[model samples]
Target chain A: MENENMNKITINIGPVHPSTHGVLKFVVEIDQDTIKKVEPEIGFVHRGVEKMAEMKYFNSFMPIADKLDYISALNWEVLYATTIENALGITVPPRAVYIRTLMCEMQRMMSHLLFLAHVGEDLGNTTLFMWGFRERELLMDLTEEVSGGRLAPMYVSIGGLYYDLPEGFSEKLLSTLSVIESKVKNEYRAMSYENGLFKMRTVGVGIISREQILKYGITGPNIRASGIKRDLRKDEPYLAYDKIDFDVVTEKAGDAYARFMVRVNEILESIRMIRQVIKDMPTGDVKVKVPWIFKIPPKYTFVRQETPRGEAAMYLVTNDDQKPYRLKIRAPSFYTLQAVKELFVGSKVADLVAILGSLDPVPGEIDR
Target chain B: MESSDTIKGRFPTLLSDVPSTNKNETVILLNDKSKLKTVVGEIKNHFDILFMLMVVDKPPKVFEMNYVFTNYSKNDILTLRVNIDRNKPSVDSISNLLGSADWEEREVYDMFGISFKGHKDLRRILLPEDWPGRPLRKDFQVTDEVRNWTGLDLKF
Candidate 1:
């Protein structure tokens, strides 16, 4: 009888594959159940965001930044606006900084919560998806209450925020935080991390070493999971992250389970950060006194900050014009995605979904 | 610290003569081909992270490529720039040292038509497979193909 091991099969998990998520395609070389190699074929969701920004006015590009990381829309806008502000030498008001920081933490919570729900669904725990979305909806409601949009909250403007938090926003935020914290704790304990099946599926699976992570320029929880104490918020504090007290969560094991645990704990820390921002927020003008349209000086500037996913960086070049000469985004997902090459080299085909879920990549961010 | 200062002070001497600035960051201009790789290697050894790679098109036949590197441990940024003739613009690829340079180098190749020697995969990323000449060059004209895709009947 001929040996079955003689044959090698190649699978194209596509630009449209549900498991692959978004427009990313993976061409996997497999032998039976073991994956020999995984080649990531990107540029599917490339909408020419950088090219479009070159044509649009500097301030008008905030809405485009909102679309890049649509899952964490407010953070994306804040990063772009802050980069412009940094280039132009403007300082945002104290109250605006606190509000921006609060909303950023809220967005961080929602992003992590969505990741939990999606990871649960990927692992066949459907109830956790509902629980995750249910909690995420409360936070989305708070976003709408403050920014007037549920998803694409283009609230952070250059040098400040677009507007102040609405009346009773603080009370609503506090109540929502309490409910989310309890639900998250219960669901995480019952369905994720602590669950035997989750541990068995994720622990020791998709393990990436600290050396490999640093070599690949991986950041955020993925790097932290490898025992690297490099959270940009704590290391390079921006906005009100410096004022608000919080812990930088890290896990020594650098596995899928470690990445998941880091995010789960980060949600609780975000709640703490939000509570502090609300309590310590000072009274001042929310918007800076600047003209609606302004020309930036001729210079190049680079700015970066911690987003829910990782370090989102923006590089801007201005030619003393209303429109920017060039805009380049160093999205965190793009860097984290590099680890997939190292993660899936020797893993089973079935474990690909779990590994990808732990990465929690936003393709819009990757392509942009 | 003195060694770092010597290297920092000698940055301009290593490159083709252009005014150098060492404010919060060090910016060196290079126009010589022989010094490009060695200068880049020196910068990379000093700064671990290659932060940004950018190409700018100046009208009528000149393109400038800039490589920015930052040393997180030392809290300093170093920028090295090279000017290339538009007709035959080509430079050495640094992707072997900085893995992050892979995509950015390809992007520079795609937009400005400046080739990076030894690039493993030099295919167009953001543009379509059969797209024409580079788009960012001042003299390069936008084709009617893009206009047709926009669903507008306006003449190009």
Candidate 2:
């Protein structure tokens, strides 16, 4: 028998709100407080970065890349830089490679920290939010020490990085890492992870299957959480990842808790990687000079890199012009969000924010 | 690379019809736009995911559509390049074939104004519905009306 309360109704959640994160609108059709269909409307923040790419010169577009995924700005900067470098057939030196790698891993850690913080707040745990940001600020300080910019740092150039590390940067970084490692392992574990109520909120909820990962073209930590054992850093071996040794973490459950576990483990793994990069650091020139008005000869150049969110890639088609003929940015979140209907359909209305946080999608790239 | 050979071997009959160009061996040029579904359906098993859908405006006449397909197990990339006439450009949507193609085809339609005939919800996914002109198109010249008109009449 259908109860009086079991009628179907629609509820809209913000093109502007906290949980949806940066100008995303979600329409959830509910049947007795259970999600029947979830439709996420994107592009509230779309500035047409692709169209802007067609107008800007090869070198001029590097700073704009930082805007796409400001959470992990360095990764996008590296990706955009690598695209032009590949098109121009320029190889970055070993030192530059290691520097890019170190900075990228740090950005990954920063991204995950914010994810943990936001997800904690979503769960109504304000203490975890404060703790997450507390640890994240240390890394932020280190990045600012080098680049002098917080959040969206325009540190990477076409050939390599904008500048090399300072004299005591490595020493300061090692100290900062040690502090982060201890806090993450101890405080974070106690606050949210090991807490029974938190686990109950997350465990076995918002399950995205392995088949769905491939179907929706979900990548990065999202796919890894589903136990696919695929990471672009290991698979393609871009930057200095091939040289460094680290494990690609995975979980069989494909639940919200599994995704959370993957990000936490990945943070530790990134710390380990940073240590390796610092130790095996080669001394050489940080950047090679590429002209500002350079042109990539007529060709279709595609570059894919693993950002904190997912497999963010850029497809550039050049035709002997100062600007790209046509540029297409394949934001992984765009694909990741496509599976929202599948993820939300059967879940309780209260668990929506928890499920969303587990995915760790930033809308900057999605709306770019 | 052996991966290229493996690709050819994986789908022998299809490759024989559509020749791969020199820009990259993975890219296969499909001359017939109508046969997109049959070809995708046949090769769908080999390609685990539709990695990306890239539609380029080739200035004077053609709209070159590149469908990048990737296999997770084999770690291989195969691009199916299909070209359509610029005037009244339309093609069969492969959203039913690959779930990943759902949003991509919509995005292509929104930006390039290339209609995917069979897409279920074909509304503008990015720009305001009332916004004039396809912005990604090469001939997208900003008119006074388009530039100045505030997006207040977004009822559509």
Candidate 3:
């Protein structure tokens, strides 16, 4: 008789759903249109990069790291390179730092642009999806100009970049960024932010409080959207972030709408940082010469970087070997997905997609 | 500095006296695994966030578990390290205190076969169910079947 009261129907959402954004599957238990529990069953796309990192040389692992987060590949590359450089006590040139910083900001913008488009599409407002990608192409052009690749570009190296910035690259970037800035201001604001349908679908749904955020280890824009001023770039500045001035955007509502707004504002902030980086751009050698056989001393170091998604950390252990003894990737999405289990409880089934989109779990990084 | 002094003053028995290797970060290695929950609970009360949890395999019957906690207010990171027996690696789960540990503890169990005693659910995360052995272990050898599946003829 007691078991009859606990009759919750299980509904499998993904593993191949369009809204999942990747190969993420969720076994959501619902009781008549209301979600009782959501169990995210990931690992469908686990490539075991950590095990593979153990076999590759210190510098050879950069490409592997690039595959961790494809949307912001440069950031992952920079994170791995800096971790190795820090372990070896290699001082990156100021010019190189500025260049890396510029690229990172651009990458952040690129990621947030995608997030905006994705969330917009998820909420049935296709205007943002169309306009955001149109603006993102301009950023991609600058990316190709600097890194020589469109996506999955492993630009940052151990000592510095693969090469120095191209001549007149700053001018081109400035021009492109200004164009992007205009579109974001006029077009995106008029289309998505003010759209009535977009507001209704997102507002007051999938709400996450500050306590829930801390309990689940959710970070980046998601936590910031919950009204917590916890951006690693602000809390613990890295890669020229200390030199720049930008506000850590936050939204107190902690709902799907707030998360969307936070990323939208973050895109604007990234543009500001990119503009500052170009203005204060130092002049020097981008790439420094290092020994062919790069061997780090026996030590363990953990380095964290504020990626577009959240705080991504690399824990490296080297036993005086050419390759790392162990490499542990602390991806933000891993915990975010964990929090999804609780995010769906007591909400209408319609809110599941909005919550999933708002959380923004990159399955590649989460499953890595 | 205040947090470091406070931890040192409080857990004099559990924390090692050795100075931290990293300048700004504080690293403490706990000698006992039984008191992990107690010490971690105290740390959570001290810090605002649990930054990361990682397991390191120190071969020949020893595994080291590292829990990194951060005080966001002061921008300080405190890493707590605990060593357990490699033969049967298990520690008290901290997921109850820090909700973030739910997935991470499962991940450690999946890769290294190091289980968390009090965890509600412990299952293979990054690999398929019924997969032969823990792939992250030092003694884990690559099977020919896996190599064939990966399209590589190399064997370990």
Candidate 4:
């Protein structure tokens, strides 16, 4: 009778659990110790972001964009502002582009740091989490030093950034990057992939095929892990990415461990990219001259760039007004969340948390 | 009908079919309902990525749905738009072809009150289940009573 009851046990693991990292829930149907089916229950924290865009002016919507993926706030702001600028046929100054690229790369590093910390904590390695957060705090300080706010730095304006880098900004950022680079490497070697138990838990688990990745529209590090050599920075070349030099990391395994390793490698690459930007830092005007209340032309445009998780896309439709007629944010986590059902179908219940942590999804991006 | 012009030079159907209204992007208009699925399949076979699907509300009771496909190999984007009547807005769900369309179609259904036939899991995604009207529709009204967030008679 106990065995019979175990066959039909269904567990709902939060729109509010600590392991979720944000507002997201998974209804897992299990048989014995193995997961039979995983139903993703989302929209718990939906603020109607798309509908809100329709009411606010195009420029005013920047603050709202900051709320989507609050962890990587600059990445969200830059992508949306660049989309609007692209639609308006405006040219952002070279300095502005460089600054945007610097911030984007920094944001990528910060986001990966958070991912590392949380994934460590999820796997019961609390020491790695502390180390990860310590480095991430240094990055956050750099971000706040430049942009003013610690979390939602509404620094990137529509045409360009709100202001230029402050005094001693380069020195401060360089030191932080150096410290994080060495510290992250040390932590990875001591507590992460180099450790046997960590490898045992992550390797050959929650495997996804390359064909399935393509079928599901997966991008960013997730796609890269499946041996795909596509990076928006390298291919599309937005916001001074063309000028910067960095390698696109890949792992052929296409497993949870591969995803983790790919992200680990990406942090090093971001450090390299940021160092290049700082070394060749250009001096010019940061903000483009534009009216306070600018009206967009009657046209529709779709813009996308590589976010840390995947491809973050913004769709903008304007109707000769200061406000956008319609706006849609194609968040990467939203797409990645769907793949969980397929991933957890055959995995054991104990490995479910590991798989979820490996995905590194920001539920704000998913639920927004 | 195999002239030298026809043999040596076939006009680029993909380029010629693109509507002129698209300034920065290419838009394809599909009129035949029966060809919708096949056209999407063909585009998918060629492009290998379908990025987004959205419903556009055209004035005077006409709805236009767009399927955006981006070809990573060719570095080109093609958008297919299908028009339907607002009174009976329905379209065949392409979730079978493009995996990402699953939730996007559900979102369209929730917002625009359009019906996607053959969708496996059709339900309100962003809005509450008991929500009365489709908020994205032009006809949907938000009364003062409904807009009040903190009151005894608040209706969400």
Winning model by TM-score: 3
Point out where model 2 deviates above 4 Å. A1-6, A18-20, B1-25, B143-149, B153-156
Which portions of model 1 show Cα errors greater than 4 Å? A1-6, A18-20, B1-12, B15-24, B71-74, B138-144, B147-156
Query: Which residues of candidate 3, in runs, are more than 4 Å off?
Result: A1-7, A18-20, B149-156
Query: Which of the numbered candidates is closest to the native, going by highest DockQ?
Result: 3
User: Pairs clashing in candidate 4?
Assistant: A14-A25
Report, for all candidates in order, the number of backbone clashes: 0, 0, 0, 1
Alpha-carbon lDDT of model 3: 0.85
**Taking the tens digit of each residue's C-alpha lDDT, what string does model 3 give over A1-368?**
76755777888988896383888888888888998888889888888899888888987888889989888898899999989888998899999999999989899899888888888778777888888788888889888887788888778988998888888988888888888888888888787777787788889988887777778778889988888888889878888999999999999999998999998889889889988988998888887887766788888878888998898999899999998999999898887878877778999888788889998889889888
> Is candidate 1 or 2 superior in DockQ?
2
How would you encode candidate 4's per-residue C-alpha lDDT over A1-368 as one tens digit per residue? 88777567898888786374787788999887888898888887777788778778787888989989988899999999888888788899989989899999999998988888888888898987888889889988888899889889998998899999999999989888888888778867778989999999899998887666766777788878878888888877788888878998999998888999999999999999999998888898998877778888888788889998887887777889888877878888887877887999989887887888888888788778
Q: All models: lDDT?
A: 0.79, 0.86, 0.85, 0.81
Minimum summed lDDT over a 10-residue window in model 1 chain B is located at B16-25
Higher-scoring candidate on lDDT, 1 or 2: 2
- DockQ of candidate 1, scored on C-alphas against the true complex (2 decimals): 0.32
Model 3: per-residue Cα lDDT over B1-156, one tens digit each? 577668767889888854555546888888878998888877877787787887889999889888988755677888888889998888899888898888888889999988898899889887877677888888887778665454344768
